[model samples]
Target: MAVALTPLSIPGRAGQLVSQLGDRAELHDVYDETGSRVYHDVSVRDTHEVRELVALVRRIPGAVLELAAGSGRLTMPLLALGREVTAVELSAAMLELLSERLAEAPERLRERCVPVQADMSSFALGRRFEVIVLGTTSISLLDEEGRAGLYAAVREHLAPGGRFLLSTVDIVTPDDPEAAEAVPEAVIAAVGAGGRAYRMHDYWPAGADTRTVTIFPAEIGDEGPVTVCTTTVGVLPVDQLGAELGRAGLTVLSGHPLPGAWRYRDVLLEVGVTA
Candidate 1:
């Protein structure tokens, strides 16, 4: 029998809870280590995808800004391509890793890349860019209101003829038993590393659409139980996302299909400004 999908609720303490967990040094350390590993591995699996993104950006003329530029994966590579890249990220730990990577980056690449730590929803850098990219579904971290605010901010910070490129997973599909079961399993496998694993055992409250992912870390032998970190991600449908972007005063340029995925390759939006 197919497991009926149920809506989940965001805890009243959701934001505070994430804030508290993110503040813990030990937890942060583990996340940092795991994230670094993931990105390093992603470069291999997604090289073609990354190349496609870079090719698209290369077609746009001028400076580029990377929103939620975790660990500088795209930032560094774009910089190496001689593009002027400014990275904006929220996590201090991730930013620290980006900074460290920048220090060891080639001089030419370092000259092209700059890192800025800030909240993407309302960040203002006293400057604008011709191209803005929110990579790897990072925008989904925000709620509807927050997503709207972020789109507005992106519009506000775009230069004349500037374009925005956003990517995300499309989770809305005809209910299929095997596919649904595989979706969560694939996500868990991708995120599991360093002897740590995560599983989504609950999607509850039937109205909230909130998901609870439980993390479990264990040693190879006799290390007993390790810590578990639970995080929730907000779900937004493609139509809702498009409507939100439109509300922010942008025109859709393209919504391309991503290869081997149930999502769009990229949703490209253009905002007109007079420089």
Candidate 2:
């Protein structure tokens, strides 16, 4: 299927660069087939919440279900815990990448992993899991309606005494709108595991309920073609998310702050079904 690419109107230095590139820019959604390659390339070596998330998973013992398990970033670690891990993903490209990684893994690790193509917002494996993880703030990728479905699906799949762990951004910086507006943007240069250098731009305005992230090659000559990927995700507050979970018959068990110094910090929330 040929996906029609839309013109991306970025809002920062990256956007300006795209404007200058004009016809040279090839825009893609971050999760698209081509862009997912770039995501897998960089994420393969990135470790943001692996330690904390795996530690949380270790406390509970049983089968694990990882939602939106792109390219098995956390899936491999979860399988390393010596448990059955079902990694569900929507992108076939990403799943292909994960399959490649697992193929090279030792039989001890590879055999325990079961890769399934499914949507995290709504899915059913006809069974329950002791630990279900939705990391990388992937929940924000869902709209309000989709998130409702995600919560419902989670509730249906949790075994008795099971825990659902997810990570999200928690704004902990300046409270005033003026101060927040002044320091809410960041541009980072990152090198992927494939040795490709990329410039990532993140911009979130004060009082806005969403943030935009755009990525492109860090070094681009005045050339013929350049691929740019961008994605916008909602900003979910802890209190709001807790309320939504409560309405869906789930409750927060605990919260752990991950290590970071961004204006908005990542908080891992452990949730369980209501009694």
lDDT of each: 0.60, 0.88
lDDT (Cα, tens digit) per residue for candidate 1, span 74-127? 787678668899999887767877888889988888888888988898888888
lDDT of 1 at 275: 34
TM-scores for every candidate against the unseen true structure: 0.71, 0.95
The model with the greatest TM-score is 2
Scored by lDDT, model 2 comes in at: 0.88
What is the C-alpha lDDT profile of model 2 across 70-105, one tens digit per residue? 999999999999999999999898899899999999
The per-residue C-alpha lDDT of model 1 at residue 6 equals 19
Q: Which ten residues in a row have the lowest lDDT in candidate 1?
A: 1-10
Which residue segments of model 1 deviate by more than 4 Å? 1-48, 172-208, 211-220, 224-230, 261-275
TM-score computed on alpha carbons, candidate 1: 0.71
